[model samples]
Target chain A: MSEDPGSPKPIVTFLGPVASYTHQATLDAFSSSDFTLTPVVTIDDVFASVQSGTSHRGVVPFENSSNGSVVFTLDLFADLQHKYPDIIVCGESYIAVQHCLLGHPDSHHASHPISVSERTGGSRVGSGVIESPLSSGAVTPTSAIPNPQKPTARPVGDLARIKKLYSHPQAWGQCKIFLNAYLKGVERQDVSSTSRAAQLVAEDLTGESAAVSSVIAAKIHGLEVLARGIEDRGDNTTRFFVIRKRAEAEVGDATSVDRKEIGKDEQGEGDWKTLVSFTIDHANPGSLAHSLAVFEKYGLNLTSINTRPSGVENWNYIFFVELKGRREEGIEDGPVNKALKSLYGVCRSWRWLGSWENRLAR
Target chain B: MSEDPGSPKPIVTFLGPVASYTHQATLDAFSSSDFTLTPVVTIDDVFASVQSGTSHRGVVPFENSSNGSVVFTLDLFADLQHKYPDIIVCGESYIAVQHCLLGHPDSHHASHPISVSERTGGSRVGSGVIESPLSSGAVTPTSAIPNPQKPTARPVGDLARIKKLYSHPQAWGQCKIFLNAYLKGVERQDVSSTSRAAQLVAEDLTGESAAVSSVIAAKIHGLEVLARGIEDRGDNTTRFFVIRKRAEAEVGDATSVDRKEIGKDEQGEGDWKTLVSFTIDHANPGSLAHSLAVFEKYGLNLTSINTRPSGVENWNYIFFVELKGRREEGIEDGPVNKALKSLYGVCRSWRWLGSWENRLAR
Candidate 1:
């Protein structure tokens, strides 16, 4: 962490309270630098904070393991970048999330119970209220369910059949496929936080709804979990990011540690990549073809191109892309440069978000 | 709907009971055809039934208004394509869903009950145990909190204050950015289905967890709804597909509908699109890039290219792509086809999905 004595510390904004994962990711990314953290309330705030100068840089959610793309993040960034040219993604990081289910002590008959009965699956469906541990008043479970299955099957007497489910959206999405398969016909909903769901569930005498949240949510919500590790995908993780005003200074072996942990093929000559986003001028025929031709001419390989509705009326778009050699003078640049030159309109722009190799060690 | 007495009718499977929106969509899409309707136990069963030949066609989720892509459907298709060469996509469709919250007659307690309090922002959060005409036994209020500002908030009264949320994983990812902003600090948990979460919460009297699910989840689960229209993004609708071993009969008006929907002018000429999938050997450099170059040389425009990890270790990959123009030779054929031929072994194989226009309006 560099201490820039002369410069004002960079103000970094991210989603959350002190315990929020995004906040932790922000700290992890900028902890060594002369940057100050300003936890914001939401992902939109992260971008807004930076745009408004409330914070030098804003960090927020982008994508997840189970879910393909964080459409909301994409929606916000694409608009912000197109509307506001001043802002750019200087860097990004992928953080994994660890999730846990929470419930109250007596909510479930046993401390740890699994496989709620099929009949009771529909029991937990809505948000419930219970007395709070922190506050003098009782707190409601953000979600709860009534126990309906034969008590003998579950072994736990108080364990409620989880009809309702609570957790962050990402958390829910990752485990959805499995949940759909396992619970079959159960009700699920989204709440403010997992803890609130836990708190509410904790108050329930019947083990109906199970909150697929974090331990923190469980603690705050006062719910004792009936099941754990219920996610469909074993690799139930999410990647988070940290944004800063300026790039961080090189710390002792940090970059190397990152690279090593990610397990990239350092030996392979072409294991690196570059991601660029661009818009084409009024969906012209042969225009994109010609543009892509340039990359071929320059020997630049094209990787992936995803097209989405541009949100602009009468201007639905096609996002053409290419993944190839690094941008250098000696590389074949004829076709690529020509393609760029041939593109039309000031509306077209591109930004590189950096290249990363698939480094997860098997 | 046409039912041919002489010919073997194609079987088209849907998500559920006849009145469901998906079922309606299937009927609308195949109303003119001779087909049999097969109701599956679950969406997965729909896919399985199609693959296993138990049903000629199966309807499954594809995309949504609020959510970007129906990942499970994608995952299923991706997996099937990767595993079985014959499992191909015949046609596609877009459907919309409308949701409502309901409760049992006994749970509807409009009066200020002792167990709960007023809602926040004038909207009651406790939809729990509301005694309504909808059910027999316990009816949960969809909105428990009539006024959130009341200083005397009970732990059981504040179902709306729920920060922790739970739902199907896909729903969470689709609503990621929205949840990150509006409901920050809320713990997110993934369950089998949003419906499951809703069901569990409805049955539980103790409050804590909140589920982000369909309105049906609230009613079926016996829980109260604190709020509605909670998707991170509005226009929250999902597209479902009815896939079968056989394609929809080439009847009437469909082509016109497709052409009208897909027709667009680009580069002062009309252009239609075709979606294709292919697999390329992983070890070879410039293999996939080389294939793309084929399109470039022929002046054929490539719209989108999405790569799915083959799940097979390090040797295979599946690429879902969209390209301009049909397969018949027209523009430049030699170079393009040659490029494809050059990477024969590297290019495991390819399948054409369909070709239409840039946009498919619902």
Candidate 2:
């Protein structure tokens, strides 16, 4: 990918290996002509890249419907934002994970067998002694037998009987509570990924192991699903952010000639999401409540609030808040921004995380 | 571990080998002596053990400050409550995780040295860099030599220069934005735990690998620290729950006696956290809003709210809420429980996730 050095598009870094989900999302967010995409290997690198000017911005996972908050992501933004004034959140994207269970073909059949038992009764009245024969060839008709030759058919017993459970640690952690109750006496292990767990379960010769992973994993691994729809919440979704350098102000007067050339297509109606990170002057009293009041005064609906101690002394805090509004819609000079500006003494540094409607949502 | 059948203590089943953190928390909540403890393998087993009457309760993780709500746990409750009518929640616990990084000693100094660099010419510029030199024997004036006797520091190159990036997947994910930023083009992998990640990073002979894990991992694995405080969020915490079969009303009364006995030693000022899981008749339009109003009317502080769609078709939605009050506190049942009970038509089931206060406040 080669381009002019003096282009408007900023470099946005994300974790990737080309086809990784993060990479796919990056492609969805920016067109090849509009942005320069760089795949980084760590969230810290995302921060450093932006701070060191190697990349204009970086994107990372913050939260999922199944998981609460990507604590590490939250921590980084909360801690480093004040020191590095240039970094800020621009926007977020929501992704739905379609999950399924997979295993080796006919894994269930190999582990569990269905046997029809024939019992002869009338030996002792109503409490008659009846003999049920096992599915093995026996010399005497009355002799009891074990199915030595029959393929082992392990009954998928109650959750209690499950001895082993596998899944990605993150996925497993989310399902921790229910798994504890149902598989009370079972062992839980974290594999590489949910898909890898499914692969392991499918390859298990005894069928005693089961994987709690995505449906995609099951399909890819060719495993028989013992159970399905095993998540705690139905509205399971994960939100991804598209971090970019704060967009430069539009030069309307300077672009008088170009104004006529600007196509109407660029005027598409877009939803707005404003992300602001600020620190309270102190930690004591109602400082947090007071800091939140700035947004409340402007009738802004705060979508999410994440906080982390600034790591300085005395419990100073850095807060990341997502609110609804755009600066271009005269919002930059609006009451909310104005109110934020007024608290310049109390507020540490308030930077916007940009606003954009999700392409998928559109 | 032995007790009279007539004087049975509450039994809570959880996945464990006794040393597990969940097992320790369970003992802390119920007291090792007053309640018989059963170890299960999975969260499902814990619930099944209770449902099958083998154990009275179960404990498992639901959400972590670092992660999120355990999705599978929530899904299991929504489904099982439909199958069994008597199961209920009784308590909750929040645990702090202090992670240490660990690895092998030989490779401890594999990464860049952690020290302030001294630059000549008045030292106007300073940048963090990773470098390894191949020179074993050389000496020259400080100003002229590039320091070849030992590995002279160069900027840490891509993962191709390093063997791999290691850490728990969650940690990796949290630091992903940063990792990718710094190691813009590298390979990332997950180990079973942060300690394991550090261990492998230290063991790698290639000297091109590093792990983004807990401080605990570095200590345990005997690896030199590369970077610390890698999480995105500073206040990373996880919440755990203790669930059990609803004790007979008389049994609850009996447990109070046990509480009093223990209270004598530990300052009896135990706090209560009420957890409730319920479902509204999915067909109703304003059913959920009306149900939530019950808590508002009673002035109950709703701590958390999570929604899950019932896997079974038509009979949809299961809502999990954490509230502040205990049944026996005579905290005034008020209109909420009464309203819940009255909604026999819409309300499905409600249970408490017990609450506890130790050094940490809920």
Candidate 3:
């Protein structure tokens, strides 16, 4: 498809007020110069924007390394596909999560030193260094009060001074170790997004409040990073998907094929993953297992499997299966097709969510 | 087992600050007269209480009809079973969720009529009738202001006056229809539990605040139910599990057996279910499907299946499966046992969570 020179750049909507992980993922996938990045209030808005044709693409989180799948996104994929059939998963990217303790920069107590007597055992009680990528390897203590009497004991910033901690629920789980050790009994207020948490703390200008967010969010909101890399796990990461409307083939390109056949020629190269969701008859024993057997018969690799309640009745579920192949040549025809055809006969219902190049290979 | 005449009543701990759904479920499972019901701060606390032998039994929510499985509880089950092997599931129960809008009774504008012009289209409009089981088959309009000019139109309690909507995140989802309708842009503050939300609203005595919780919770917190049965769906229900320490057989009981043979006599009766968790070799194609086939071979019906990341690596997951049968009779000697033995040979790891009499059959 050729772009008109004068036409406005395509808008990419993502889950955010700004500087959220989804916003960072959107930036990683598309160049800011080529596309206008817009932040919406919720994940539903991201899908709605693409479905309404207001935005050309939408970015949303699919899963986290430590927390498992984002169930709401999976449920939306099941609910919205029937209406927005053209919207497909086109690309995927991963973002390393680094949670930081953010506080008001101008507050007088921002650099107050934590008393040695207050340091609980097992808590990270060393010098409270704000570890940024730009910082040197040595710990740069941010505390204003440096006790010379205890040279061996490094002074750390006082976390006890903060009465309220604002963060997304997921962030709380990620920073459980830090919260449990140092900030135990502090009031934790759950916000819609981490960026919003940073924004609240920044806007309040209260030294008494802090937020668990990213350095990017702290920077954007004009907040100070009191501590960094506070997540319980070092390998904390979130995978995001870039979704766009399915387009028809252009007339000029000789090799161009129908949208349905876009991934056919690229199949069997082992660089694609397709996601499909289906519901089986709960009354029948092994119905799900039998349907899954078809994948083995086709020599297909099942990458992931998840289940969510169908909401119709107790114990009824809709299963989402991610397979190692594309939709066209890799899955739509031959053995994969045969398995799906058989699945169609036995299962109550099923649908293909999308096929995209596997991001793990990167 | 025989109860000692002078022994203290068994203590049952559940996730609670009191008046939470788990508290309600715990009440439903055992009579207060026979058990000393205790409330804990978190789900982890409930498990800790059971493992530490501080409480004889623990109650926790397993699944919701609308929202799907509680992943935290599932993850805790996987983590705690290795440490507390003897703490097995003893029973199950279900509680119908009836969310109500609660406010302080002494507030001057507690029964103010909702302005028709204030409601945005998607929010629940028209007469807001609070449905209660005690009321006859008639709409109970609690509005203090009755507009005599519009005789046919039912005046409803004003939601616009509510400045803050406090609730558990799940409660917010369940009451979205009502929230979106009347209190369009109100600030939503997420609390630790729904009952805590009620407690906050009741304590504030501010005519400006409200909470989304159960009528029972409102009563417990000394608040008035402004509106009842406000959840979007009528079938909203949560299933809870009763857990207790394994007991050794007494000499006098004729039916007494070892813990290994606990469910043997109860099998083939079609009134029991078992929960098991296992991790399969992710590299192998259809290894999970193959393992699941053993259930079908045994003529055992699979009730539900869910997957959570094992936290080892990406694309690596631990699957939780619930089957229709007891452990000793339905699983130990016959097809279920054979299937599990085969699964043990193929799977990387597997563990039995527990077996309990099926509450659905009741």
Candidate 4:
């Protein structure tokens, strides 16, 4: 997947300081060697990077299976559409999120010496174990560096010794079952991202703090993983969108972007989805119903529907709807085009967020 | 509003350690002298208190004007309906959330002497300010207690001197404009609640830390307010529900419970609302459209709709719908009853969370 020496590799930016779930998704969707990956501080930064043309592409977490929609991402889409109409979701990928209880290696209780080698069976920290290429390559050198003095056995910690637990708020909610059983009453602090929590624990080696983060984060920050897969559900997955600005020629090409050929069925049909957002007349009782009926009328399948406060007024909302069809397919008389045309007639305002190949099954 | 000497005051529990926005809402809805208000650690605890009949009522935040839905409250309602079907939303109250920059009096930088007198005009530290009764009464005695030694001028803090800012995640979002403008690069830490953030800052007293919380929190914790109304919007508000367990005879009695009669309009027709959650067949693309159509067919106005992961399977979701009618008023050939009957026919599973007197205008 590495690019030729003469070719200028496209830069891909994602929400991160590195080792975040978004970073993992970015790696999954694009080959690191083929693209120069950069980490931005916030989700807004990811959008700004793509919008400003500083980065050729960007990735962001759209939703978590357990936590439902990421309101920040949805709200940003609504705001960015008007400002940067050419920005579109080019592709998407899912990463299975497994949260681990991570602590500063020095903070482990002396009574329980748990070495990194013992946990991974000496497979080298984060090497081929977490399915993240960045974590494996980034942490291998750090783990190989020998201490000047002989290293003492690293201590393993429990809830009793951990005075503080840091993680993204979503991670805390995902691991509620484990937290309630073991770390009940522990002070949980939320950080901007899970990797930031790990970085903080590493920086403040008080030996009294732990972070709920990904194994990749623990490896990148040289923290020890005390427990793995701590989320309440085993099937915890987060879907991320790989977005990019449309080309100059593609400015008004809402239904003409070339669809990527991947995950095709035997019938030679590739699954695809389109995202759109719009506002309706708040005074009409059945305005939402009338708007949604256009999909049914056009024989289009609606995958998801979410409502967010418009922030303009109380009880006023904007709806984000995902439909199961590509914008380009069967155009001129396609179900998606027909449904969208009828939708514009009913909605007060509307915008096409993007259309991309669908990855998640119905 | 005080109860008779012989009468036992009803116990009211809310999500709190006191000085929380929920506490303010509880006070606004019920007279403190008439009801013995208690602080519970979590929203779940508040629900448990009401479900177990340990408290006459419980108060929990329903939504924030800026951040939109409180998914925790919505998810809890979906879960609690099956276990305690009799528990209902009896009433509601709104609290205007004004976030204050609270810090330890001694932590201010030496160069900037920001006295409480200078910022609040010697207003007795949250005294007669901020509409919350809890702030006025609970902190008055402490604020009145003068130090034996003459007080030195407390130094005011700027963004550069503060090393960390603590607040609820919602507060961080609410005060984004202020934070981005003044404290661009300061480390932001998320606590359980706004008041809890104040408590932590008060406990640490490092002089380099601050909290974004209510004026009530600052007063109770003896912290000085460096600034007030720091939220992005002036009309920032959070709505809370006053919930109670219904009696056996009142199980089906949606109306006719003793109405508290606070904030009632002169017309005597109290607006009513009902909340219900249902899941539909994921394979059926138009199932949700069909289910929502039931509301339009029966003329029930939907004020809000939110989607949450059912948590049982991937791509499966439960829809929470808030409509403008009470269960009893539109039952027995009413629109609400007819709409619900049709909804049940289309959904895979459904539960009636509760119906309460509507407080927020459409």
Candidate 5:
């Protein structure tokens, strides 16, 4: 909200340690010059930083192409409408995820750093980097800077020499085919996140351990890349949401409703997406079907849907539904607003999570 | 499929290490005297045993109320219709989950094992046991028996005495409230599962660690339940499905179709639940909404719905839909058969995972 010329750059927090896919998303969401970026350890911390007004914006991984919903993020939205009155999703970013096997620069061997293209079926991982976004003075001296351990040891041997592999639990599954083939008997040790995995490898005095992390992480942590694009699929990607506080009256909905002024694209491709989650009388027949049909009545195309436990009872679920609305217009002027308005009558309880520009660029 | 009175009791494989929740679910699914129980470390192994015909049946945790759909299980069914033909879900079981803080019984406080009912807000844990299910001749001599490390240490102090806490990643979230209030700042070390956490505690000779595990695991590992019923919710439960290979053609669906042979109950109560997953043309605006509408056409009540990455491509999801059908009717005789029959026309591609009696027993 404070992008005025010469205004102090507002801090944008993300789930990170400077090299996670989420960090990649933060750089993509707001131009580096517009805000000062910082890292938080968890998704909850990202939201808390924004919720408490400690951070101006927050970027969180909403879902992954292969792993499905980041339920932890979704679970945080349960009763979020009342819990955090101002935070709302403002934009989204897509990160092309390519995991690489990283190791201590001193422990791993390659004679020299080689581009992946030199190997069979390998592609060059863009030495993705963020030049001084965090190191810049835009961040206050009080802020903790990421000061990674510099590698001082000499080079060692190949994959066969590695005894233990450190990785976030999710990475192991995504890179299973490669792990089973090349590092079959290597011991896997799970860390909390990919950033942590890389950090662990950087700190490993053993030189016998490695990790699966982003190429950026390898660079940030001063580790050497041992293998590139190890994930099962070449097109693996993660989607994220950029959030900031929204003042209610600034919403311009409720009182002065704009009926039928949807801007530009009528087709689904460029339409904005609105996400809302709710619970219904699951015991009653046709409740969910009827709830879904409401999207059809108002001509809102349903794009994605998911379910999570509501926490109140066993088997009772809360459903998250996303729908596409014409982009150029205010949501109040499109089927999204009308459909959400009607859900009050249809759902047992509901919360409008957020609406954001459909910036799903690959 | 071979539970003949004189036949070698068929091996029923489950995801486990003796006293995990899946082990509990296995005990509930099959009468111990009728089958030999075995433990496989991963969910994939549970399915693998059944698919390779190495085991007679398999039991896998399907979903947990607090944790939602076990995506691993859901993803396993993506191409299951053809990949593992005949391995159909036949029965279901519910396991009430209550995680306890367990430590080496010798290094634990409390001169005696006190019932949880003695604590401020505690209740008695059932001390669930599967007396020698794994040890009796029910299992083959070659099967690896759970031989826990005998704790030769002696009693220590209270929660403050815990130097480190061990738990499965999921258990950490479920007991956050209790952990924060009592064991704040204790180092948490994650294990593969709750059972592994218990086993590690049993093996700890230093007597400085504790684990969040099931009461049965505490008993089986010769550990003390330092604190019981520690999960945030009292009624936390996990639902599981039992699968076995059915001889083709034994399925009475196609030829003599039970089209009109509806069972006694037409109401939702006591109705059987059918689960199916399908993909729709995501690019088409109304494809998903229309696919869901098909269920309404057949008047089937969708009891549950979940979406997982189809894995064929990014964001192309496979939806798992469960609907209720009359108990006394064959799936072919009720709306489930009719709805699934219609899905082929509505969805881009579909797979019938399995159907079983709706056993949402608390």
Candidate 6:
């Protein structure tokens, strides 16, 4: 859906430095739209852009592969709700964080170059005919490159050539098996970020180092795939929420703001899910159980329920419950509205956070 | 309790510098013990130290004030369960993170030095009689220092003397109002950690720079207090779990393992809280609700509940439920034992993570 050429293109911002995973997700979310993509330094800035009407939409990480909730983002919602009450989630998109070992273009590759795409079930890397290394088959290492001056075979002895491995400290644990099995004792240098590791490798084209970074970073920084899918564990996929300001929210024009219809697209009624956060009288042991039952009573199956500490007090928590609902119906007539009304009695405080397309079910 | 002087002190490790909040909490947990307090570079190392028996006990962050679950710590439990199956949580402790504006002993203080202890109601800074800034009172700046060279009153004009402020990037947002009101034009430098910030100011001793760091850091680095409780929002109190290796568990003699008695102390049965994680068949909409209901039926009050992505699949999650229970009795005779057996019927898989003292109730 491209907008009118004459109209100012709606700005979309994400936690950036172009080839970061969040940037990759932002590009995929607005691939066909006429929106202009901008990079923000922090997630808080991404929310601020939408909240201030500087951007029509913002993409911020909602969940991590290993961590169900992106606490940084959730905490922002709790902290900034007062500053920007109209900020709401419109849609969500997921990006698989399949880390790859990148190298300078002239660097050597692994002996058996399994097709990264094939092993990862055709990730953003797209289709490849080569088989996985686990199945007793491997693609030629030269086939991994788009252009090759030296299309020689992957010398098994090349392990000695990699004098140093570069990656963010967080990546080291994920690739322990690989590091032990292949590059044992190779000097490892910790960089600030995975993308930064790739940039370093690209800049210093000595072909003596490799970085564990994203495929997008390799492509953006002119690095070659040394060995794909270097991460031996914690196969992570991050989900991001595309958010925007409710129309006319700044002027306090409540009549023009459609609360229930937020971020609704061509998806069917069954595809939409609404997320709400509430705090119960935690001193009362039964309050939380009673609140969960209310959602079940309305036949609103909670797809996900998580808790974040309400910063107002040390141990007090705000429970985030997401459930299927129809967004077409107005807030007053919607089943979510009715369930929330019942849920409120058991809650000390509550807020309807947002509604978005349920990627989990899809 | 003092151990035998002849015996080696039980080594306890934490994520640290000598004065990080984690270090502060670790000291508090073993205040009177004949234990060695060692510092580790990463949380994973802290876990590994206990798992490998390098440390008798390890203190790691379990929950953040704004995030109910410490994702890094929780994800480690999920990732390393098989490696350290007998690693059990022994106890927990809480530390209030009261950010202080620290400076070299010779640096200038704020105009109105309100008593931090009075305002925060006795953080680890302990008791002081000066009323809070809100209560319209000020303590002479020199009184804040142990051996003041100058006992003169705080000059509001001294705000212009601050050429730069150092802090971890995370602290800037927490103290926005204070920064805006006083140090608006000061050059802010981002350091690696809050403790490091205090060190910078201490080593420089320029009196023209200050740091936003923990009070503990100020004491450790010999920095004088300039202002206290600078964080205007998101009053964060982190909870830490003190973990230890279960005795003789690497032998895999399950029969000899007494799970319920893993971490019994002077605390009564009513003070204990057990945390367990499980995954349910998400295909059925009622599975989670059913799992939650089993707890209510068993009279277990769920103190906290959170979800983490299973990491095996994109949308799949493992639920963490913490409930108040008695652990003195044998596992077979305990009320939690019956509830988990009943709870497992609704789940595809489960694990009894650990039990600890619920510090929140106190």
Q: What is the C-alpha RMSD of each candidate to the true structure, in Å?
A: 11.2, 13.6, 7.3, 9.8, 11.6, 11.3
List model 5 lDDT by residue over B182-275, tens digit each: 6655667666679989998889877778899988988888787766676776767888888766545544221121111122122435657777
**Candidate 4 Cα misplacement greater than 4 A, ranges:** A1-6, A80-82, A106-161, A247-270, B1-7, B80-82, B106-160, B247-257, B264-270
Provide TM-scores for the models.
0.61, 0.53, 0.82, 0.81, 0.78, 0.68
Give i-RMS (Å) per prediction.
Answer: 5.0, 8.8, 2.0, 1.8, 2.0, 4.6
How much lDDT does each candidate structure score?
A: 0.49, 0.50, 0.69, 0.72, 0.68, 0.66
lDDT per residue, candidate 4, B29-60, as tens digits?
Answer: 77776678888888888888898888888899
Model 5 docking category? acceptable
TM-score for candidate 4, residues paired by index: 0.81
Quality class of the docking in candidate 3, CAPRI style: acceptable
Q: Pick the candidate with the highest lDDT.
A: 4
* Poorest stretch of ten by lDDT in candidate 6 chain B: B147-156
Can you tell me the CAPRI class of model 2? incorrect
Over the stretch A1-362, how does candidate 4's per-residue lDDT look in tens digits? 22245757777898897999999888877676667788888888888888888787889999999898888888888783355666788778899998887875432334454443443342322211222122222211223323311221121233345668888888978887666655666666777799999998888767678888988998799887766677877788999998888766542332322222123233423577889888888787677778877787876777788887787876588989888886664455777777777887887888777777677754
Displacement of residue B255 (Cα, Å) in model 2 is: 2.9
What docking grade applies to model 1?
incorrect
Candidate 6: share of reference interface contacts reproduced:
0.48
Pick by TM-score: 5 or 6, better one:
5
True contacts kept of each: 0.27, 0.00, 0.51, 0.52, 0.67, 0.48
Residue B68 displacement in candidate 6 (angstroms): 4.8
How far out, in Å, is residue A361 in model 2?
Answer: 3.5
* Two-chain DockQ for each candidate model: 0.18, 0.06, 0.46, 0.44, 0.45, 0.26
Q: What is the lDDT of residue B196 in candidate 3?
A: 91
lDDT of 1 by residue, A22-118 (tens): 6546765565255566765557667777766667666676555555555556666556335433344534555555555554444232334333343
